[model samples]
Target chain A: MSENTTYREAVKRAIHKAMKEDERVFLMGEDVGRYGGSYAVSMGFLEEFGSERIIDTPLCESGFTGAGIGAAVNGMRPIVEIMTINFSFLALDQIINSASKLLYMSGGQFNVPIVIRMATGGGNQLGAQHSHSLEGWYAHVPGLKVLTPATVQDAYDMVGLALDHPDPILIFENSNLYNTKGELDTNATPLPIGKAKIHREGKDLTLLTYGVNLLKALKAHERLAKEGIDVEVIDLRSLRPLDDEAIMASVKKTHRVMIVDEGWKSGSISAEIMARINEQAFYELDAPMVRVCSAEVPFPYAEHLERAAMPQVDEIVAMAHKVMEES
Target chain B: MSEFIMPSLGADMESAVLMEWKIKEGDKVKKGDIIAEVETSKGVIEIEIFEDGIVEKLLVEPETECKVGTPLAIIHSVSERINISPAAKKRAKELGVDLEKLASQTKGTINLSQVEATDEKTETKAPTTDGMRQAIARAMSKSNTEIPHYYLSTSINMTAALKWLEELNSQRPIGERILPAALLIHAIVLALKKVPQLNGFWQNDTQEIISEINPGIAIALRKGGLITPAILNTQEMNLNETMHSLDDLITRTRTGKLKGGEMTQQTITITNLGDLGIESVFGVIYPPQVAIVGIGNIMDVPWAENDMLCARKVVKVTLAGDHRATDGRIGAQFLDKLDKILQKPEELL
Candidate 1:
């Protein structure tokens, strides 16, 4: 069965289903109980699951995140929400050093089965403080798995997959995608984590993207198709433990790549993907890899400046054309 | 007993200042040992002793300027000599092996095998020469500006020559065997006799077909530069004689023992880059000379003979002829004659 839903509603339905099925699963974060959620994802969940399951916390990121890790290690599956990715820096020590390492540090005696979710990306004009996509930083950590859900189906699926994983996992939900509506197939086969999905296939160039940029790349591909420049669109659903087989297959077919990422250009996820392509499929490439990424600057407060800093649909189209012209 | 004179270090050098004596009177010195330093226009160069001797007298004083052949020192030859077999000595001369350098490397009497090993070890390219680097740069720049060269090439099937060489080497001793380069040089001289149009110079606004066939052989120095010294009067020699002269020329070129006339008397040049694994080489004419012949790597290639396809060893030969000295027809005829000569390898001997 399929139903029309926004990314926020699909995510809320997935969390509600996990709460109904597992008794050990609980939700905890600041203002998660009485105020519903910062984005109203869990409205009225405090009354339905009661205060025991929908627990609230004080305004301390590190303390609450560490407590969630401790509870996860003991035998409970806790879903910890860190409001925005920019504020997650306050709990960096617990996320990378503590939660990410506890399984191996304890000699495999204890596993921190916790899922940390945060709103990422910079299209909402939340100013420099609240709008930052720092998922690539967490992807750099070895022991952690990172997932960026771009579609409503993935938003419903990846959250349940992360909760079932034995180690720590971080889900970056782009704030701009919260209200974007799409059809969600509830009975579709679940996709395994760390596998990329191809939205459209072509012979000219491979367009690799994730998060909100996936939609922008799809739009760019439609425009390029009209101009007779066929482009293959691939959504890298998971960042860490990247699907190298999928990437190499597309690269060998098209012999050209254009990575569109919302993160900044330097040391960003696009750089990592480009490096992997060079290492594994360098001889298959006909031209150098191209990328359209966010400008290396703090997110601006003004709407026009913010739009200019992030990658747009027109830029992705232009970069794809550039790759075709080079080949 | 011999007098060590001021050696001509380069074609352009005529005089240098005696900088300092590293050894005094009565000091015993072996071969390849540096005994003095001279200040040339290039830089301070350390001069090595060519013989094992005891210094009898220092003829030139420090800071005194001297011409190219002026006596710099006098030494008495040592009786305790490094012995080498007569066969090995003959082989070394033909191979142009530096016996003094070979003597410094071994303790016992040297044999033919040891001399061959030394020749094989010195084939690789090494570091650089500061002055030779600048000289090459200036000459190449001049050649690029003045010479309008026309290049032509052809592939020679070497099935007959290689088979003949293998059969000939099987019957002879190791010391008497001739290399493929020697055979190629012999054929080139014979071909030049037929097409005298290429064996000459472009001077005084006309082509000068010199009677003497002094073909310059481009030898790359171990210290990272190149020098082309001619094997004078190849038209008067046979295959074995040409091979011996080539070896002696190479040895003297490396040891700084070249005569002044060999540097400026080249009528035509030949560069064999086959040992470096190059597939084809089109060399630039080293000015004054009208043409340069280049030989590339020989490898097995497919051939069609009498409507049958088979593999035959083949090599690519190229000629870079100055447009003013010769036309394409003459260059093509020369290559055709060279191919015919190589086919009858027995006639070359």
Candidate 2:
């Protein structure tokens, strides 16, 4: 049985299922209890699980994130939520140095089985202070698993899988994707952490993306199909430990690649993926690898500027045309 | 210093025995200078250097057969030890400044003032066109002196071929139309494919049949001399592609833009003297190649078809083959195949 639900409800149900199954599981973050999550993801959770299980902390990201990591180390499974990725910088040291390195530093005696979820990306007219996407930064850190769930099914499955992981895991939810609706199987099995999914099969070119940009890429694929330009769309569900096998296989078949990234172009994840493709599958490419990344400037407050700053479907379609036209 | 490796002269040329060196160590060489002679399956070819340099070391001894890409010598660039500003470099090129002489006179960076002083002091050289004629004289004399040649001629009826080509060209624009020369080259390629023995080199007391057919087209330059640069891999081209390549090759050859591989990679040569109103020609086979096909003027000649004497457009075709590699029978077979192909010119398309 499958249920049609938004990404927010799918995540809320995954967390509720975890809390019901595991006594060690508890939710902790600012306004997670009384506020029912800053995005209303935990509505009615406090009333059902009570104050002890659905606990909310003061406005301090580093303090509560550190407490959650410490609790996980002491045999408690805690899901820590940050209101936005822009504020996650306040807990960068705790997440990178403490939570990520604790198991290796303790000689595998203590494991930081903590899960941190942060709302990321811009498109909601949120100013630069609230709308930065820092998932690429977290992915650069070793010893930490990074997951970006774009679809509702992945949102539900990835959360359930991240809680079962022994090491620290971070799930970056694109802020604009919470309202996007898709089908979620009631008994959906958890997807493997580092495997990518091919949403469409094509022979002309491969379009790689994740998070909210995946939707735009799909729309661009539809537009390109009308013009006889067949495109393959792949969602890189995991940022760290990228699926090189899947990426190379698509490159071998299509012979062209266009990466769509919401992050800035310079030193971004898209650059890293291009470097990897050049290193491993250089001869398979017929045309140079192209990327459509966000503008280097910070997120603009105006809706028009924000839309222009981010990579859009039209830009993706135009870039696909340019790539196809090349050898 | 950069190593000068043995280049693959043709598609089938894998290795070459170093026969002689035209330059020794400490010799200053300019680009396009014949620095060495290497003997491959196609006979001794004069190898040209592509950079202005001084010979630093000789790596391969004469008579040593080395594989392609084996370093034969090391050449140290003349300008490597000297620093010249961008403006000075441009001025030197315009003045044809002798960098070696300028380097001997100065130290540190060579600037525009030094270039101007050198240009004023040195005598400017006059342009000469006799060098190409002299090179052709040496190569043709070598071919006449070394190889025993045998010649044969046949008359091919071009009435059908010309009519077919005229109809085909009528449908296309002027620039995209095919010419009779392209059809002739295509027919020769097809004939070579049928009688493969004549489409190769006469080397080392035997005939070496090359896998790919590269026919050198003898195109006369506008000035006084002529060059025969091979249309590489003619076997793969159709009539239209053959026409395009022939046009491109002629333009580049006249402009002195032919590449080194085109100069040394001919399996056979084709010389057409028809445009000059010559009734017949017995061409000298370019050395190392076994045969040369010559096309003469197409004229209205008396023909007896089905015992009826009538006028027909016919062309005089001649083949000169190396007596050592092939015989009169092979040349006759090739000419026959070529005549049959021209009878159905649409097959070339």
Candidate 3:
């Protein structure tokens, strides 16, 4: 059942499966149809599902994003593909005001079943404008299901599950993970939204992370294991509705937590996790909560500067050392 | 000056009576030396010093029932003192604050607000333990109400096992005699391996099988309540390791020196009433965990072998399991496997 595939190919298979299963489902974006995709996410969708299902729109994020909301309110499941998360800012009014509030503002008479997918995060020298990790910003807004699938199996399963969600869903895919190859289980089951997966079992400290940083934490955990410092690495598949039970259970065992996030440190998702840990498991902690987030800067252009700006495996290992040894 | 306070002997002990002081003022002592004997709810424990110093003053008198953190003596070392705020000193006097806690907070000066903040924690030590008892009560009551538990009992021949254990003990010293409880625990865990359904928690609408066979021994405290701390990974250990771990667990359980995570990750529980000479026991299931096993006193009984009557040593084993997690048939299979393992006692080692 294991099919070795790239992260981009897994996503394309999920989209391909979902569109074939339902006629109401379609993909709409700037370059998703004939131009293949900005990152080839919907590369062959126009040739297979036809141009009607593979909608190629103008270079306007807000316009197409609003159209997704309109189609969703009228009982069509349209998956909006924003080329990059940096450009999602241009569609803020559509995402926040219309898609998010349609069901509640209309007294539950209307519901938006729109799944918005975007290429997010740093690496690959995407520079400042194209490389951004703002999934945390969308997580702050209510009525939006924010999912960040970190594994190949999850990339194949998460999108199809999001299509059935009644409200809007925002799927954040890391740009760095597109070429990362992994074994995708053909019989992969859909993971429930808001639940986290423990990538490695350990007893020293929990490294909570999502998306691209999940790999970094796993790498650090492996090296830490060799040094006799057992660390638990958790990939938070869902960004919002933080799984407090999983977080607290790990913290209660380890009594320490180090969050690795690609987002900037200030007011990032890591801050939210720290606050939750404090509220729930403050006395259980043997040491202070620590985090290794991207350095507060616009995504850098140079290779060295970009690597320095974002979270690295070495930083995660160092943070784990601080949490375990500083006590 | 280093202050020695009344130590909380166990998680349940809020206070203890200072029975005797082994050292007097002007006497020098080293770390790890027994300095005093305090009578806790469990029993009298000889407390040890963690630092080297000269006894400067004996603040507490004998036969005084002091709450935990009440200063007993002051030991002066070669080091000097840091200036404590006057308000902090007054607050410490009023609250009888434990200065060791403050030392960890700041190595420099102690302040008034720190004492005020720490006072609430010390004041509610009793309630915190009561909170733990209440937590246990909640889980037990939840198990009782929600779970439909079925009890099963079986009598297994123990003649081969008792003879094997007696022969094995002949070679060991008097101080290292392996008790029958260790063999019972070994049999229980091996049987659990064959029937793993009884070793996991039924929670979150899922039946998760706990891989590690951690069996909690229910040790009744001398004070009043019972604390069940587990012997971790008994399946990975031999009969000697199991005997040593069980002995260590009991001593630490009574003295309140149990290791970290010892009481938390109990996959299953074992209650042995053989020591009390009880015929059989039916223990309530500790919630989260689905099963509780009981071992009774081994006695000589008349048995039929190949259509002939004969005398054989047998013991009653009872299992109370959550019907939601497992059935009566599974319980029978587990007991059947246990009976088979008892016949081959060498496998336990």
Best model per TM-score: 3
Please state the CAPRI-style docking class of candidate 3: incorrect
For model 2, which pairs clash? none
Candidate 3, number of clashes: 0
Deviating ranges (above 4 Å) for candidate 1: B1-349
Between candidates 2 and 3, the lDDT winner: 2
Provide i-RMS per model in Å.
Answer: 27.2, 18.1, 10.7
TM-score, candidate 3, is 0.53
Reference-based lDDT, each prediction = 0.89, 0.89, 0.87
TM-score of the B chain in each candidate versus the native B chain: 0.63, 0.66, 0.63
Task: Give model 2's DockQ, 2 decimals.
Answer: 0.01
Model 3 chain A weakest lDDT span, ten residues long = A280-289
User: How many clashes would you count in candidate 1?
Assistant: 2
- Tens digits of per-residue lDDT for model 1, A1-327: 999999999999989999999998999998889999887788889999999999898888999999999999999999999888988999999999999999899999999999998889888878988889889888999889999999999999988999999999999999889998998987888799999999999988899999999999999999999999989999999999799999999987787799998888899889999999989987566666899988888999899999999999999888887766654
User: Which one wins on lDDT?
Assistant: 2
